[model samples]
Target: MNLELTASNVYKSYNGNQVIRDCSYSFDMCDIYILTGPNGSGKSTFLRICALLENPDRGEIEYSSEQRVLKKDLELRRRITLVLPRVGVFNASVYRNISYGLAIRGIKGGDFREKVNRMIEFVGLRNKKDQNALTLSSGETQRLGIARALIIEPGILFLDEPTTSVDQANTGIIEDIILKMKEEHKTTVVVATHDKDQAKRLGDKVLMMNDGKIIPT
Candidate 1:
């Protein structure tokens, strides 16, 4: 497996309360890594660090490809998109919500439309594309959030408890889409969830975290 992302001796704290303690791990390219733990077990914090949303107090994260090296934070961010546990939909149409990331990245007109339409279709939200994003159900909103993330064409994806707010049908749909992403796009996925069933279903490797430490079981 290729080492797409690596963290070495990572430690973090908030007001002297240690959250992550000397944790180190590597994410392989095109593989699904599941971080399974109880609430407040530092899974999301670890993911935030990997996504570069938050800087580690002490650690080094490296990302690279075969021909190009992702050395800077900006380069890594472009390649890795993080979907938070709570879906925050913009007060806009579902189409806009799906196309927002591309719009911010200077993609407009037909290019953005093509990508957004494909993503909405992939997430099975094509019918709701014209509806207000904030008016969608929790499950639809989560699917919309995932579509938004996928529109960025990220090489690595970080999902924090992606199934929490979703219904069974949508959860199954999202699971299929994620499996397809791994098979087709070869995107490395790191998911943080306390759901053991989901971990077993999607994870190629499971990191069981507890009490601020990763138990390599």
Candidate 2:
């Protein structure tokens, strides 16, 4: 597999408090990595930098592979999607919410319906497809969040605490989808979590972070 993203000498600080310090890492295509650490360890911050959501204080972040190069933030963001835990969906119906990315990317008209419908069913939202998004329960909302992220068909998927505060059934559902992503699409997956069981089950490479640095395993 080719290298998808690389961060060299990365650093971040807020109010003079350093969150990520000289964090350097690289991810390859189709690699699934899990980030684990205690609270305030900057796991999410590192992920944000990789996702282009936050700029590092001092670092070079780049995305390149054999087939293409992501030279701009918008280009990179379009391919690198993030699904945050407890994410708030926009006020819309579930079907509309699932197709929101497609609309934004100018993928509209009758062509989008089949893709959106497939994603809705893939996330097991067939019954709730026409319901209001805000009325769904937390588990259902999480499913919708995952579906929204998948609708873009990102090359690299970053998940922050995906299973946090969710019940076992929902966790299983999310895990199933993730497995399919890895097997079918070969999407590079980076996940931050406190669940050791999940990490063991899903991570091909486990990364342990502490105080803004990754502890070498």
Candidate 3:
């Protein structure tokens, strides 16, 4: 499931305040891309537009694979995922939270349970599998959000400021998970971060955004 995302001359605005202006870039298959910028520089907005959670006022976000452009449909949306800075959680168990995506896709039973357990362990939450998700700490909650995203095994994963709200230790854990995701899953990853060091740590290619445009390398 190799995927390519191309944003051509994309523009977005809110209340006449332009956030992203004439931004364009391509996300190649199986590579980690980092969008680095200061807050209000439109990194989040660009990620949202590319993730299809929001549409651009001008220009298009096109997704394609195997040299053919794919239609913007439910199937395409399912192939990708976006984890925002503030992760939304269900008032359920850790297992339930991680299994939700697969469950909705009609995946269940022993095999499904096994997959969910693996994800729990992957996020270092195996010991808390039965705990209520809303009760977890901020760092653990972030890990759970990532676990939930990974359980679906998306072809493209968009992570927005993954470490912005976590402690140093949890940041390390999340970074490990992302690295392993690249090595094992080969999922194309797009991470938005304001930390220059973090961008260097995770990005195969660092895309710097300032004033709503990509700074060419």
Candidate 4:
């Protein structure tokens, strides 16, 4: 199904200070959108609202297909995943960290093992499958976080500064995986980043924001 997400007249504030000022944008399925801006530009705040991680103070978020609106409920949320700027890992083995989501979702047995193994290899952590997640380097932890999110196969993926702390080598790997996701799973990806080059490489359409407003690109 072709999914569409729309945000209208979105506004958010913190302590009487507005951050996202009447921001509005729409995105369709299977496309990569890069929200690029300097720090405090409200890119991350906008992404968080769209990803349903944070609610907009005054706005409406609508999900639709074939011009029909779908209720924004738990089921809709299940189709979306967000990876924050700071990577969070379980204090467990790499294999366990990768498999935890599947397990919670009632996936088990051979199917579970196969999916977990595939993700570990896909993220280049096959050799560290049994290693503790906390012991992994920053790059490795970020990869693991991506793997964990991707294993669930969300229809929409939100990444906030995914390559912020990653090194040059791992940055390439992360970008590759994101492209692969768009091609194979048709995931709609929304990324908030500060790097213009990275945005050009991954974004089908790039939106520039400054001081809580999107500038014309």
Best by TM-score: 3
State which candidate, 2 or 3, has the greater TM-score. Answer: 3
Clashing pairs in 1: none
Q: After aligning candidate 1 to the native by TM-score, how far in Å is the CA of 190 from where it should be?
A: 0.5
Taking all chains together, the TM-score of candidate 4 against the true structure is: 0.95
Leading candidate by lDDT: 3
Pairs clashing within candidate 2: none
Model 3 alpha-carbon drift over 4 Å, by segment: none
Clashing pairs in 4: none
Model 2 misplacement above 4 A: 1-3, 67-69
The sequence of per-residue lDDT tens digits that candidate 4 reaches over residues 124-214 is: 9999999999999878888888889889888788898999988999899999988988998788888889999999999998999888877
Q: What is the C-alpha lDDT of each candidate?
A: 0.84, 0.87, 0.92, 0.88
Candidate 2, residues 45-92, lDDT tens digits: the string is 998888888889998888887956668567567888888887778888
lDDT (10s digit) by residue, model 1, range 190-214: 8888989988888888999886667
The whole-model C-alpha lDDT of candidate 2 against the native structure comes to 0.87
What TM-score, to 2 decimals, does candidate 1 have? 0.93
Ranking by lDDT: 3, 4, 2, 1
